[model samples]
Target chain A: MHTAGVTLQQVAQQAGVSLATASRVLHGSGSRTVGEELRRRVEAAAQELRYVSNAPAQALARATSDVVGLIVHDVADPYFGAIAAGAMRAAREQRLMVMIAATFREPGLELEYLRSLRAQRARAVILAGSGTADADATARLAEEIAGFEADGGRVVCVGERGPDLDTVVMANRGGGGLAARGLWDLGHRRIGVVSGPAELLTVRHRLDGARRALRSLGAPLAPDAVTVGDFTREGGRVAAVRLLRARPDLTAVLVLNDVMAAGALAGLRDDLGLAVPDRVSVVGFDDVPFAADLRPALSTVRLPLEAAGEAAVRLLLEPSGDEPRRVALAAELVLRDSTATTVG
Target chain B: MHTAGVTLQQVAQQAGVSLATASRVLHGSGSRTVGEELRRRVEAAAQELRYVSNAPAQALARATSDVVGLIVHDVADPYFGAIAAGAMRAAREQRLMVMIAATFREPGLELEYLRSLRAQRARAVILAGSGTADADATARLAEEIAGFEADGGRVVCVGERGPDLDTVVMANRGGGGLAARGLWDLGHRRIGVVSGPAELLTVRHRLDGARRALRSLGAPLAPDAVTVGDFTREGGRVAAVRLLRARPDLTAVLVLNDVMAAGALAGLRDDLGLAVPDRVSVVGFDDVPFAADLRPALSTVRLPLEAAGEAAVRLLLEPSGDEPRRVALAAELVLRDSTATTVG
Candidate 1:
């Protein structure tokens, strides 16, 4: 109003295109895919004019929240934080917002919140909660997400998408296999396991990989060697205790998460009085912010949590030609001071 | 309707009163404060017939957005999750809703979001982010909040209100002093400190308290004893290294946060190769979920984040009358396995 004079219509006139065409090119409208030539022209014109679009009107016209629902089991978990960062970046790319819903590991509350989410007219829903105690509970959650889709809502479930739902998941089994191979490479035979909730699909996949690795070494998993926890620090402490009690001769422990791994470390040092790496080695999943900050620099599986979030939002908002997206992000092993070679 | 038929006006008529009086009496509108005879007649009539009032008309007459604003620094921080839970509970009690505005630790973004927050016709704004990096910034934020109040919106800033704010804060300084005194009583000397952002009032207050304790001990803070960080795990590690380098002869380190404390432990062990408790001891603030789960469990000053959120809401919704309401939550030091006596 004061100095710089420019608008989308002006840009459209300069670009020899309609206002809608200009908007499609400028706004990167998710409703339709823009061709390369028009997009480049619109971008150049908008840049020349320094055109700025009002988000509110565009959002109102969409009659949608411009918010993607990111449902996770626990907001406090550092693992989920990575996923959230990814989703936020992707959502921001489309000028969409990300709304987080933490169910606190309760399936019933999650179901109740899903109803409320429906009322918000959310652009899409990304279901990612996995650490549940029962398979039927997750199956029911999947049913609800399926119903949400049936009602013409968009959804992208991670890890375990039901048959009727569209999803973008990681190669969890492969990630687990990688972890197992890393453990095997460390010459860890009598290894103890600290697992996440039994109901979670990732736990099953990771467990399968662990079993496969053990079988490859011609070593059977000792009875009661694997202990399951709720994927919390307290759970990790309790599970570590159980594992150590059952397999005192174990030289290494693999925990499902960094938080629980931190817990297991405390329990081993304080309760069991074991020297890290010298007496026993500890490996954890989910390379959280504090993983490197830990004394032993938790040698764990690093999953692209943030990328998953971003990809989930993109997959939900922009529907590409009918191939159901099964985008599996990469995972890598970060070696640290936690694991020690078995000493004679 | 085959129900107990007893007119409330009958009781009023028998008592020689009008319908309005009968209605008031039967509803027990002023039963406790009004005349005893009127109250008795109202109670008797209400017992005879359960005549419900016209709630629909009252509801029709009322118009409100039934929404509040939750302004937070960053959703990435786990501490905010508990606070959110508390505020949500209070919102449910008040029959209103909340929308979270994530500031991402920027004052300009916070200001921009506040404008949108105001336009949403929010009944109140809950301020949960005070980065403490800029007093002037917070003051400006307070002024903006005051402006919002002038425009008929209520504001409640969490963690302590300044002269221009209505704050529900905690005894952060007192907690810090207590932590310092505990270390002193345990006979630990040559302590290193990890402080929060210098600009934050809460961080400054804690720093002042620690200084006060050191002053009481008739000792001066070593030039290299204290390091400031941004309150992240990475920040903690950076600060811890400085503290250790400055005071290699030091035995104890007090960090401002648990995440930082975890980082401090990593630096102490990985960088300095010091055995915890025997060669070094560490304490942190904020007993977050995983605080106690860490190896050599974090000894921290616990600030009830959730309770403060609930208290803040309660303060904002209710009137304080002649008294200026400033709710101060108490912070307590949780002793755990992390700290130990400095030994040669």
Candidate 2:
């Protein structure tokens, strides 16, 4: 019956061909040859029967699959959306199916997904989520990656998963420096930072770079000037309010990411009733799609996020060398209407 | 040896258990039972050997997989991102892994992905992309869907795909009417529409509703007032510019989606030197995450995108009935600063 999936025997019988010939024409499993006319007959019969080869069975026989796994922290975040799009495009070019798994920024979920993807025998697993600051979690993730690799699956990390692994490193620290230097060059002395969770490597690197730049400028970021929040818009809004409430004299604020920067803009303009640039300047990082459309047109660091995603997939598909390969992408500053010269 | 994947025989030997016992303990296959102590030993042995159960093999034996496939028109679009996030959340609660595939709105790619998912033996498939207006393509998709169902897999369509399939229908027509009536009540008669490709079912239903409402109000949408473009920001920008150049007397514009609407706002404000609401009003649909954050705050129709995504997964998981089930979610109007009374 059709409910049980059409059998290859029926297709072969209908096409008046041998089972081996039908299998070769449809599944292309063995190195076998069939006449052109017979091949067409088998194909026509298979189409008539709506026959779909069992991929799982084929994978079991070959010990590999045509599926690639993309692991992200959150699917809803536009940051990940752009990256996933690039990765999927590259995957399509290779005629491989990309299966995305979102971790929701939970370390446990990330590991669980890694294990699941490994067990599913995905040919390659792209870890696009940021690395965690927790040492134990990092070690466990490294172990999982090792297990995946040991099982003949390739692993590509987007943002510093660990040492000795194929990675596409984004210039997070350099972007942070650029944001701080840009604000400092505009003559803003008293500045605060809206930071995401301290456990994320992205947050740490960005904050560290900004701190170094400000220190070099002879105005170290004060301990009280940094307010940590979730890596979300609401988090940015709330943190901006708290930072400003505590440091009312601060002339500018640097948000760790664009989404938070958007919230910071709303917080400064709507919640605090302050005029942007004239009273308080705001800078964001990772110029996302809507960054240019915000009220003041967010001035942030431009990271070629989509390109980085494409690069990750490329590295994964490339031949593995004795040592893991590294591809670093640069981040540049984008000046928009969001930042301006400070006024007394 | 590890690259070849740890074998069940090795694990059984390490655990001092029989092959059948190890298979049941690790893969949960067959009805054979093992003692509690022996089960723990087998699990520990498998962990020690780093043995990952071959999912493809297990799926072949069980005739299903724990993986569910989600097909979308585009992964980078925030509208789909929101829905995917909701579906993933619901899937996690049910202990199922979700594999998302983006078609990039290509009819051929959509059909190809459906076939691929079916070949992978995905337990269920959630078709989140909008149906096309092409009858031949629709028929092919329907035939492929029937093949998948015949293989004992579940199918859930997020939008109006076909009759006799579980569908979560959004109030596209009603929302279109609401958008038109809302603009009409503001005394805007010469309204232009920045529409997406007319081949899309979503575009047709929304336009149909708007036209019906306008006709009843004694003011039908002029054919010359509609400018169709790609379902993207640039498309909206170019469409808005073209529409306005042709009919400079128009005071309001209706954009099909928020991303394009964002572009329309820029096209009108920056390119055309028109102030939002003051010079011309704009209305958008979908009310994506950044709609409220956009400059001037977009006024649009709000669809329960995430909830709809969750509903699709729920429907797929539920026991199939003799007849297909339908779930319709309502869309409401959200008035923001983007719209105002028309200036005569």
- Clash number for every model? 8, 0
Candidate 2: residue A37 Cα off by (Å): 4.9
lDDT string, candidate 2, B1-344, tens digits: 12478778999999999988899898764577789999999999998988877888778877788888999988889999999999999999987888888898889988998999888899999999689989999999998898888889999999888888999999999999999999999989899888999989888888888889898999999999999988999999989988899999999999999999999999998899989998899999998999999989999999999999999999988877998999999999999999999757
Candidate 1: tens digits of C-alpha lDDT, residues A234-273 = 7888899788977888888888878888888877877888
- Tens digit of lDDT per residue, candidate 1, span B1-344? 10222344666676667666776665443544557787677666654543333211211122123457787776657677668667866775775556665666767767766655554445678888554656687667766675566555677888755644678877778887878887877778787789878877777778778778887887656757888987777788888888788778887778987777878777777787877767877888878776776666688889898898789889878853445578888889888888877553
Which candidate wins on TM-score? 2
TM-score to true structure, per model? 0.75, 0.95
Q: How does each model score on lDDT?
A: 0.70, 0.90
